[model samples]
Target: MSETTAEKIPVTVLTGYLGAGKTTLLNRILSENHGKKYAVIVNEFGEIGIDNDLIIGADEEVFEMNNGCICCTVRGDLVRILDGLMKRKGKFDAIIVETTGLADPAPVAQTFFVDEDVQNNARLDAVVTVADAKWLSDRLKDAPEAKNQIAFADVIVLNKTDLVTPPELAEVEGRIRAINPYAKLHRTQRCQVALSDVLERGAFDLDRILELEPEFLAADEHDHDHEHCHDENCTHEHHHHDHDHHHDHDHGHGHGMKHYHDEDMQSLSLHSDKPLDPNKFMPWLQQLVATEGQKILRSKGILAFSGDDDRYVFQGVHMMLEGDHQRAWKEGEPRQSRLVFIGRELPEQTIRDGFERCIAA
Candidate 1:
């Protein structure tokens, strides 16, 4: 019999570019009596403080005790805060993590899977990305975070739709579709979508996930090893970045306060020691392309091709994906499949699962 793991509770991560209406949507979710309790987490009270009046004035029940909604100064504080929330398991039915406009989401997600304390308590539900329809395309032209936010989302919300003309809306939607094909897109104005529509959508599932990826099944057959999977107190912190620090570092284009303005191309590398099936994995890839393709500066990876000794190499632009053989697993060489995603703070897990769906259970 194959070894199976226990199911973990899900928490949603909400992200978007600066002034993209994330707080408005969050306020709406907090007010909705959707029959589920939500514990809100964010960078700081002051960051989203501007929208407090709107959030508090909304009809939903408001609870702002001294430290209930998890907020932190540094990115590293997320794990400890999430651990605190898990202790009160019955107090809230779910958790909602809101990232600052300047924030990157990769490190936030790494906390869930990499940290023992966090992984033991909470599971990632889904990544919901909000976009300012009126200004997103212009922002992505020079902002890497904007693209990353879109590429990583399981659900994409095109907020401020009313501000854009029909042609502008169509152009932005087309751009979003090219970058991420798998994420569900929500069109709204002033974050006016139903809270139930975004939060209660039931986007993540473990059992159903097995049915989605075939590559994992085969990869599971082989003994795999990874440096980050150990039980020791995880100290490695995944930093959410807005630019490709590789060649652009010397140019000093995306550092400090300017980080939010860096429009350079970015990429992320995803690796798994496990083999995966192609059938289940295709949806995530398609979703990525359809939702955030235009913002995608670049993407490429080696996937385990089913029934063939050769590995598959997939490359794509905004909504366009092309793949062919890269190389075959060599004797004594690592057979692990790895994919590098270079776009703005694209959620690694969503992209990880895109290929993860290919894993055969």
Candidate 2:
């Protein structure tokens, strides 16, 4: 459905590992002149709803889930809270669920799917992940939560890119790519990406699934040489921004990076040039997730099934998978099936063999 649909309020789940700059990006989103009202539901450690007080409005609500929203227990609270929020829906334009840096985003996302009330009123707009460029590589080596955050992201804000060297930056980006090649990757400093790139993206909207390949968006980088603001202390009485400090070196850094792979967390991408048999593909996909969901972190696809004219779209978090016939194939659209999975200890050969079996003869 289109984002303009009045039926469902869009929700953006913001997640990241500790010290990944999620709050910074969130503040940028709220601080900017977007002319949109957002209802923010935040759960931070230490019960400090400091950010909530900073936001202004009758529509803006903040209920702290003191314990991290890591599992199904918190999911219940989320569902109830969302159900209550729906009653006052018309007051706010969109909702932002900001999970703690350490919290898993799966349960938060699942709320929209599992709850009938939430599903009827709110849509999962996107999972926007913020990553720390200087330390993500190290975190990936030791932290599974960090890997999951990166894997589940629809839009990834690669924040603090200026903190790392060119090689380190590329290494981090390559590491992120290894896990999720379909996310819209944007590089930023102090989480300064354009609000448009993050909020109300319609990232999860079926009609917006134009491409599966990751987009390299040079966000927060529009060449405007006018009205330079260099002093860090300047409070922007005149909203001037040069942002040119990193422009020269940042322009030429994407191609030379070495591909760094996480041994446990890897993405498996499968594509078929021919149409797939829906009857076979659907059952196999369900069975695959049923047995291996624990190992899988995220899954998404756009499919071309035999005897079907519309492009089929699907998205999954662990075992919970959802798909629908989006739109009819355009005149020159290529009929192809593309699937991606980010998970731990993936049964790659088994998956490949299984998918091959689903191709139409």
Candidate 3:
């Protein structure tokens, strides 16, 4: 017997309101004197790439091109772009997706769990929301997207702290605690926080999620009317799922009742007692990423492939992909493979069929 093949990959999503210094922060990270290499993807990246050029010399390893805006245009395409990047995975140490300020975090987070191509390659590091300390107090209350961004963030940066007073910062921090009390908060002047503090936070803990969304967990045990339906065998309960683990809390906070959703995102897990062929798995995953990518915000899992000693652990956010052979299985452990798909209103049977078709004998 051997252990299951699955590893968590870290992908940091950089989000904020317009002119909240997201690009500036990205530039600072890329230009850091550190030896690590990073792959970057941005909507209107060509325009932003120009800025990077102004700051540093050309390097293709830093990809800043657009298939479309990640939130809407290239919602499912992120995994494809990630697959291409993996062709040269050794050239970069990590991936950073800089999303448009006005976008919703749900769709972005959904990408990591739904796309097979991504689930085969990478893991979600964390969702980092960079907020303007002065403006966010108002934005969180008024903007729906702002609330969602905060709700999904693993790390929140109260940027531009220099411009605000200590009392104002304290007030903003209080509001954040009300919405998402679990996410780690960092005070930064112009988004200058240390990279180590933001990435791989894994702050969205199961205990916290259950506390915030027990209804979602309960819905699985007892049938309830839901906007989205999953397969009969599939349930969206977090704690009951094998993939559920005790992880750190991540996600932003601070919106009013208007920001709270009647429906939390849905998650469906597919477990196979057997191995899957990579050739069949790839196309089905790419198709899934292309078709329902927006609805399928995030997809991740560990896969056991036939005739392979090493297991594949993967993560996907929209079209972005990051995955690797995490490690060889340990002695006397079961080699079961499992995947978790989370999205807004996913059709469970559809996902199950797609996965079933990819099974190897």
Indicate which candidate wins on lDDT.
2
TM-score between candidate 3 and the true structure:
0.51
Instruction: Give model 1's TM-score versus the native structure.
Output: 0.54
Could you say which candidate leads in TM-score?
A: 2
lDDT of each: 0.57, 0.71, 0.60
Per-candidate TM equals 0.54, 0.80, 0.51
Per residue, candidate 3 scores C-alpha lDDT tens digits across 103-200 of 76655555565555675667666788888889887987678677666655667787898888766775666555334433456888978888878765
lDDT of 2 at 234: 24
User: 313, model 3: CA deviation in Å?
Assistant: 17
lDDT of 1 by residue, 254-305 (tens): 2121123233443455656567676666777777766765445445556775
Q: Which portions of model 1 show Cα errors greater than 4 Å?
A: 1-7, 46-75, 200-206, 210-361
Could you give candidate 2's per-residue lDDT for residues 38-63 as a string of tens digits? 77776653333344432322222224
Candidate 2: minimum summed lDDT over ten consecutive residues — where? 234-243
Ranking by TM-score: 2, 1, 3
Number of backbone collisions per candidate: 55, 0, 38
Off by over 4 Å in 3: 1-9, 46-74, 202-361
